[model samples]
Target chain A: MALLNKDGSRLDGRGVTDLRPLKITAGVLNRAAGSCLIEWGRNKVLAAVYGPHEVFPKHLTNPRRALINARYIMAPFSSQEEHGRSGPNRRSIEISKVARHVFENVVFTERFPKTMIDVHMEVLQSDGGTRVSAITAASVALADAGIPMRDLVCGVSVGRVDGKLVVDLDKYEDNLGESDVPVVISPRTKELLLFQLDGLLSKKEVSEGLDMIFEAANVIREKQVQALADKFKDVDSGDLQ
Target chain B: MILEEIKEDYIKELLKQKKRIDGRALDAYREIKITKDFIQNAEGSAIAEVGGTKVLAGVKFDIMTPFADRPDEGVVMFGSEFSPIAHPDFNAGPPDENSIELARVVDRGIRSAESIDVKSLFLEEGKVLGVFVDLYILDHSGNLIDTAGLAAMSALKNTKIPKVEDGKIIRNEFTGKLKLVREVAVTTFEKIDGVIIADANSEEEVASEGRMSLSTSSDGFVCSAQKSGKAGFSKQELMDLIDLSSEKSKELLRHI
Candidate 1:
């Protein structure tokens, strides 16, 4: 079968199960209550949190819990191929739903009733794992906004390329790779909120992919927490200058 | 003109006590944030955040045959478009007149100041050109002229010529800096309540009846000027602003 590479190698110079370089930053936006920009290899995502305030439209309000409204946008010039439009698209809408679901379960929505929190994410560049990167960045932005949450949500994508499993595929690998599995889990509770597979994968391959993604999520979650600590650790009042 | 009335009221306040909502004096400008070489893919790029306004510009080089008339010199083109994604008011389509005016004014400032060495851009006399400058406006808060001009200069200064090997585009491993000829700085003055203020924001821009954007090089010379207000300034006021722009240019060019 041509499923595996002749030399047993992925398209990129990566091993069977290796994650891409990951970096996350919080409080990048000045106006937003909370904001962050995360870079996973060449992919870059910026997430911002706006509310937890009173709901604007009466019809959209829920008295028992807060509502989560999220939108994902990709910049027009970000890709080599022309991105369709200047605004959100079908794929962005799907990612928005998945991202909203992941954060809705983790955030303490019951604490702020009759209010809606707007989380908007823009992908400046896209490799694979944009959804997971959104989830990872959204949670940090929420925390940066001073919103209470049960635990930090960590997102990671694992995929099978050339019959071998890989973690956090970059754009080059993602577009040409065979299959991908993205998992968003609460690292503290170990509860998976979203599981999605794109392209194709066998049942056994899916299981192995999830295991590698979750293990890597733990390492990423620690880094996410440390970034928060480092941002607010010991800045004097005069440091704003 | 939903904001016209609000702007007029604010202008009145500025005339009374020379104060702005952000608390800058009549002639004072907001804090400026200048960052260079931000984008990795482009040959050179810069992000200049003045107050709440942000502009990111990048320079990309492509080999092209020189124009028939200007065979001895390379070509330089500038474009500015406000993305609708950045604001609700920005609409889709080709750039409106406002956007065109902004690009031309900034382009004139650079050209008049001769910040770029056009002669050096010609790789082979009457053959191919070595450089091109592409200015992009990522966001528009207010006073786009100054922000765009600063970003264009920063991006050009950070640019490096690519290495051409055997008529093929090979990566340039050797590193060197571009040779900048002059430094030009733009100062946008909004005429509010019969007074002039430096670096107006979106709100202040709407409040003022007119605006005067001036660009000056580091050598105390005026490069370009744009007047867009209904009300005209007196001769003394015009001269005073030119002097102010020259001093401001010196201060800003040093930081670059």
Candidate 2:
């Protein structure tokens, strides 16, 4: 079946450039230094930050700067699969590595030397675009922890479905889509923090997809800021700056 | 010289002068040597050496029931083990993030390019043949991803699909060469001192602030890409790197 309606609307009645409904809340975990819960469409991801504390095994520590440790975990019942296993399996491991890399670029690790800061993202439910949702929530969790950062990072997946480019694909489109390109950016600086391509796409198509991601990221960035502001409403807004 | 110059600083200084620690040009790769049939017991095998790094890839086949979701499709799995013998940093344990990432990157390149005709391996409604590319890092000087990728691709090129008789295995007998659609190779660049250097060695890898690896297929398109380390690239910089990778991968595929 064609993914689009005769009226140029997506299967979900969204325009090509429209994003899924998103909601983000900070300080969702009391035990952790900071935490965030993000619900985007049918996905729910929670990100937590702990430490800037002593290192384990000792050797992994860097004397000049802190080590950024990030991991992504998917609960066994988190997905639509036939009871997906609680996995840090090869796929999750690879995603965790890239998630850690993006955070490493934005965190001010120099401010806390000889320490390790752990950022963990747990996926409660995943429909599609879990990686982007995880990292987006992780950014808010870091801010809630009072960690200094260059900017709030945002990410979105752009897809070519039914030979038409679209923003923020749902699980249905993701499976039948011709291409999936996930691009992440540090919204303040416009630096690409994460880039991955997983379909047969020409350079031009991928290039155009990047532009779509850039525009979609603004919406995510705004929500991240709003969530943080709401979390710290009791204090002066100047304190946030 | 700055008083606080560390090992990374020294390498970056050389990079600023358009010279690497080993005097290679900014965009030049280390010499690559591939040894095919390195393991006779396996269905296919190759050892790829790039500078001081060595990755051995072996291909083996097994018969299994297809996955529940995709019953008609055959499976191609890539596994990488960073043996302690490779480097001091590696330990004897289950696969870590770096090793997992390496295997996945190589797997993506091959799968994205459709290098193998998986459909041909289907035997029955539920039964299928599984191709496994097992990579061992005998030495880890640096740039293990490219070395592993080359080794896997070369091993695939040398593979022969084992003949099946009534859905039973024939180990020593031949069933003709495996049908390969195209070759894929990876090109990696590390940014140091704000300059991108290709095929970095151990010292250069340590000094680098960011790293990007692009996998290009023989049909002239980037099949996969990964950006790592603690830095980001502008869109223009990323595009330029992709162009460079597409060009460099041609030379690599020719060697296979």
TM-scores of the candidates are 0.50, 0.95
How would you encode candidate 1's per-residue C-alpha lDDT over B5-103 as one tens digit per residue?
Answer: 466686677677877867887777777888988988778889887777888887776667787646876677787777776565788887665666677
TM-score of model 2 vs. true structure: 0.95
List clashing residue pairs in candidate 1.
B210-B229
lDDT of each: 0.73, 0.87
Q: For candidate 2, write residues B92-157 as lDDT tens digits.
A: 999988998899888888888888988888889999999999999999888999999999999999
Residue B222 Cα positional deviation in candidate 2, in Å, after optimal superposition: 1.7
List the candidate 2 regions with Cα displacement exceeding 4 Å.
A6-8, A236-241, B1-6
Compose the digit string of candidate 1's lDDT tens values, residues A1-241: 2433567755555566666777889999999999999988777989999998888787879989999887777888666565548876545655665567666777788999999999998888876677788778888999999899888888887766665788887666665566555677777756556654444344345556767876898789987998788778776768777
Query: Which regions of candidate 1 fall more than 4 Å away from where they truly are?
Result: A1-241, B1-7, B171-175
| Docking category of candidate 1 | incorrect
State iRMS for model 2. Answer: 1.1
